[model samples]
Every structure is written in C-alpha cells, then in structure tokens.
Target: MRTPLPGVAAACGLAAMLLLGACTATGRQASDGAAVAPSPADEAAQQSTVDTKWGPLGPADRDLIVRVRQAALWEIPVGRQAQRRAARTTTRRNLGEIARRHAGSDALARQAAVKLNVPLPDQPTPEQQSWLSEITGKSGNDYDRTAIARMRTADGLLYASIGAVRGSTRNTLVRAFAEKCEPAVRARLKLLEGTGFVTGDTLPDPPQVASAPLPGNPKQPASPAPAATALLAGR
Candidate 1:
C-alpha cells in the first residue's frame, strides 16, 4: 500500500487510543458499580452479616415485624374514621391518639423491613379489611361501638402476639420494637374497655372449675383427719 499521509496516520492513532481508553474506563466502571451504590438486596445481605445494636434478627423477629406492620396498616385508617364519626369525645380522642401511634409504628416497621429484606403487604389482612368495612358503614353510636369492638379485638390479638414475641424473641431489635408497641396497645385496650364497647371478648374468661361430681358418683374419699386434730378433739 502507498505510504499513509502523516496527518491520516496521526488521526488513526488518536482514534485507536480513544477507543482503548473508553473500553478500559467501561471495564473499571463495571467493576466499581456494585460497591458505589448497593442494591437493596445487596444492602440487606450486608446488613445480615453485620452485628446490629440488637442481636441479629431471626425468623421470629421477621414474623413479628410483618404482623405489627399489618396491624398498623389496618388500624391507622379505621382509627381515622372512628375519630371523625364516633359520637363520643373520648372515643374520638382515643381514636386520634391510636391513629397517630399506629402511623409511627408502621413507619418503624417499614424501616425494619427494608433493613432486613422482609417483604411487607401493602394491604391489611382479610379479617382486618372486613372489620374496616363494617366499621366504615356505621355512624354515631353504632360506629363508635363497632370501632371500639374492632380495636379491642385487634389489640387483644396484638397483645397476645407481643407477649409471645417478648418471651421468645432473642433479637434485641425485635424485643425493643415489641416493648415500644406494648404500652400503646395496652393503653388503647384500656381506653376501649372504658368505653363499655368492649364487653365481649375483653372480659376475663370465667374461672374453669372441675365439674361437680356426678350426682350418682361417690364423692372423692375424704382424707383422714390429721393426728393433731384428733388429739385436740380428745383434749
């Protein structure tokens, strides 16, 4: 081939250098991208390894988180409705306070889920939805009673769950969350009880006693009187 012009050769060399530099830069970027901005899954994986202020979360901790989140989602909206439609000032005030607390609780649950890589449901459980629908359709005293009853039922379940988690969870984070939530739930339960709307399941279960001996059955054999009692009688 005829010798290439000096200017053409120079241009060709520069283009090759530019192309090589671009490829090298792209390779560097590909290598560094993961470290520079971690994906949520990546972040979660990293978090799983690191020791948390509370002990590392376990399955029970995750389950508690999901349950609390669902409760919050269900309660907050219904509580708002109760605040607006409840006939009594006390009902309205209590509902308002509960709504505020649940809102905060929901936020905490979301933060925990993100950190733990747990997926949260966007909607409440079906039972909670049904309760909400029932409460939403009522007005005045009817609404008040329904709202309080629903809250009582929910808080009762929540209280039980918290108790279970408190006793079982080893993770400090889960324990802390349950402890923080317990007082609010108990306060709501007490307020609902005061409204007289929580009369059914809220009542303590009747003491379970053994059935009276069947009429025809011989009574349990009486134990022999103590020797001390016999001596006293003789005296």
Candidate 2:
C-alpha cells in the first residue's frame, strides 16, 4: 500500500483524538468518582496517537518544524560559499541576497524553536554538510551550477515541508511560522531559477493559483480569476 502523506496522517490522528476526548467528557460517570472503560472509538483513538508521535503536535508537524530549522541553518553557510565562489556577477548578487534572507530565516526559526520548546541543532544535518563540502570543492561555472542545484533541491524539500505544516499543523505557532517564512522561500527559489542554473524539473511545483496581474498588464485582469478557473488553468 502507498504510504499516506504525513499531513493527512497527522490530521486523521488529531481528529480521532478530539473525537475521543469529546466522547470521554460526555461519557457516563460512575458512583465513586471513577471513570468507566473507554469505548471502542476511544480505544482506537488512543491507538492512533501511539502510531504517531504525540504532544502539542503529531509526528508530521514536529518533523516539519525540525526540517525547517535545519534548512535555515544549512542555507546560511552554503549561501555564503556561493557568494565567495560564484564567478558571475548576477549569480554572486543573487547568492548574497539568498545568504541575507536565510540569516533572517535562521533567526526566526530559532525564535520559534524557543517558543515551542523544541531543541534545534547548532549546525546543519550530516546530509547538508555533505552538500556543502561538494559545493566548496568546485569553482567558476561548475561552482555556480553546483551551488544553484543544491539550493534548488534544498528549497524544494523545504517548500514541501512548509506547505505540509501550514496546511495541517495542530499547533497555531507552527502554522503561523510556516506562513510567515513561505514568501521568502518562494522568492529565493525564483531567484535561483532566474540564474538559469537550476532546471524546471529540479524545482518544486508552482503555486496552483497564479499571482495577480501587474498594474499595466492588459491580457489578464489585475484581480485574480475565480479559484476554480485558476486551478483549471494550472492543470
């Protein structure tokens, strides 16, 4: 069987818990202030929680938060390397902007981790360190290409995780954090794409809804079309 998406699994698990809690609260109370055995639904809900990590979040939300912080930490050093090693003026400028953006994102991620009482790593994950080493070993056009490709891959993975957290996280803090960082991540991806080093296949899928037309655009209205139209057009 195909594995369920993390967000979906988390949502189902959360819903089951809420339903179980509601049932327990309304359950018949015994004479000695003792609670009766849980119903089958309650048993199933308890089991669901066991299937995933439980706290203020399910497994998916916790994983997403960790990955986001890791990505932020990873990007800062890699972006700096790109700034120093990229030969093209445009590539160097874009990398500089990327480094600046991720520095800010790293701070935000740290703040979120503190508020959520989550422990964040002092350095990037092992896989990220490997990518950094590979990028650092190249120079000129090769460095530019390698750097952009690595960033593209990282951004794509972050994009997917952020999208998942924003949509299904039970914790309000995590949802808000994901929403806040999405635009910068998206903008960085676009900048990397503009460098012509990353290919379309390597990038994450574009947003389903097209952005509003610019002020002077005549072919399309400034206001977005109906959501359905945008979805259909994307397809």
Candidate 3:
C-alpha cells in the first residue's frame, strides 16, 4: 500500500546528477539528466518558498505534527494483516530516530526533528494493536498498525518505536497527510524540525522498539506542491 509517491528530490536529484537523469523545478524528471532545475542563483532570487502548512507548527499543533509524522512512516493501511505482517520491521522507527537526532536536543532542535512522532504499540502489545485495529477498519495491513499481531524481526536489525502523544487515533493525522498536511513539514522536518544535530550515527533507543520484520531504518519543501512517492518509502 505504498502511496504512489513522487520521486524524492534527493534520491531522484542524485539520480539525475549521479545517475545521469534529468529533473525539473517542479520535480518531474527528464531522460537526459542534464535539464536545469532552479540553480542556487535562481532559488536565491525568489520570495522564501514557505510551506503554508508549517505555519501550523506553532505550539498549539505540536500535538498534530507529532502524529502526522508517525502515521506517514507507517503508511500501511488496514484489513490485510498479512502484508502488514510481512512488511513490519524496526526500520521506520530506527531510521526515523536517527533522522531526528541527526537534526539535536534543544527545544528548537526537536521541533525540526523530521519524520513523524506518532506512536505505535510494541510487539508484545496486542491490546495496543487492537486499539489501532478499531480505527482503520478497512485499509491495507502492509503498513497498518494491525501488523503487530504477527509482527516479525530479524536478529541483526536494531529497533525502536514510541509515541509523542497517548491514545491518539493515529488515523486523524494520517488522513490529514493523505489528503494534504503541510509543505514545510514535508520539506524540512528532518532538516529543521527534529532533534538537535549530531556528528555521528547513534543507535535508535531500545525502549521505543516495537513489532516488525527488520531492524530500524529510515520530509519537504515549498512551491507548487510536494509529492506522494517522495513522501513514501523511497524518499
């Protein structure tokens, strides 16, 4: 159930630069790999391409930002628990934490912590998974919360998962993002939102670990709009 996302700029952009693919200012790509996107000089001239959604990142909505980030990472839907079961892993949480911490510990830092902070119940927590089941009753389980019932994990992968808020519908924010959340969050969550920056890689926290198949692993911009594929896993 990976949403048909737009190509991530970094991934696709690098492909264009390194792989010889071409990309446009709005993100569409060309076969030549030599097309001109906005050069730094071009980007420097425009008004700040502020994502209107980030304006909501103010204190009152800290709660929503926390959840939207969470749901997007677990973009799996409901019903088909097996696929969710098949895809479950520590990757999202682990990589997610890394992305955030890479950004610091200060108030201003965590705010920029990219990646969502919505919580997921752990491998040992069926009741919690059940809670998730109640909400998204008709979606794909590939990335659904219900995947926890038969969650799997490999030995080498480290894991961590936690929630910034307690007892949220998780779906509340998912719908917002699925429909349309904020542009800034998508563009800069990892860069300017999450934890304070760090110089080295650190293992994601343990207590936060949850149901899944593999170890942990692991946002946005302004202008016309953002993308679906980019927002999904490939990004």
Q: What TM-score number comes out for model 2?
A: 0.63
Q: What TM-score do all the candidates reach, one by one? A: 0.60, 0.63, 0.18
Residues 1-235, candidate 2: write the lDDT tens digits. Answer: 3343223334334334433332112222244434456687755543332221333554445455566677767777777777777888878888878888877677777887776555566666555676778889998898998788778766765676677667766677777788888887898998888888886544434434347854766785577558887779957
Q: Candidate 2 overall Cα lDDT vs. reference?
A: 0.65
Compare candidates 2 and 3 on lDDT and give the better one: 2
TM-score of 1: 0.60
Task: Write the residue-wise lDDT of candidate 3 on 1-235 in tens digits.
Answer: 2221122222223222211212123221234333346566544432122223333222212323333333332322222332233232342343344334322222222333443342222121222244345434534433332232212110001011112211222233322432333332333233212222211222211222257666434323335546676679654
Candidate 1 off by > 4 Å? 1-56, 200-235
The weakest ten consecutive residues by lDDT in model 3 span 153-162
Candidate 2 ranges beyond 4 A from true positions: 1-55, 201-235
Cα shift from native, residue 39, model 3 (Å): 49
How many steric clashes does model 3 contain? 48
State each model's CA lDDT, in order: 0.65, 0.65, 0.29
Ranking according to lDDT, highest score first: 2, 1, 3
lDDT of 1 by residue, 62-148 (tens): 656776787787788977877778899888888878888887778878887787676777776555676788888998888998777
RMSD (Cα, Å) for all candidates, in order, is: 24.4, 13.8, 21.4
TM-score comparison, 2 vs 3, better candidate:
2
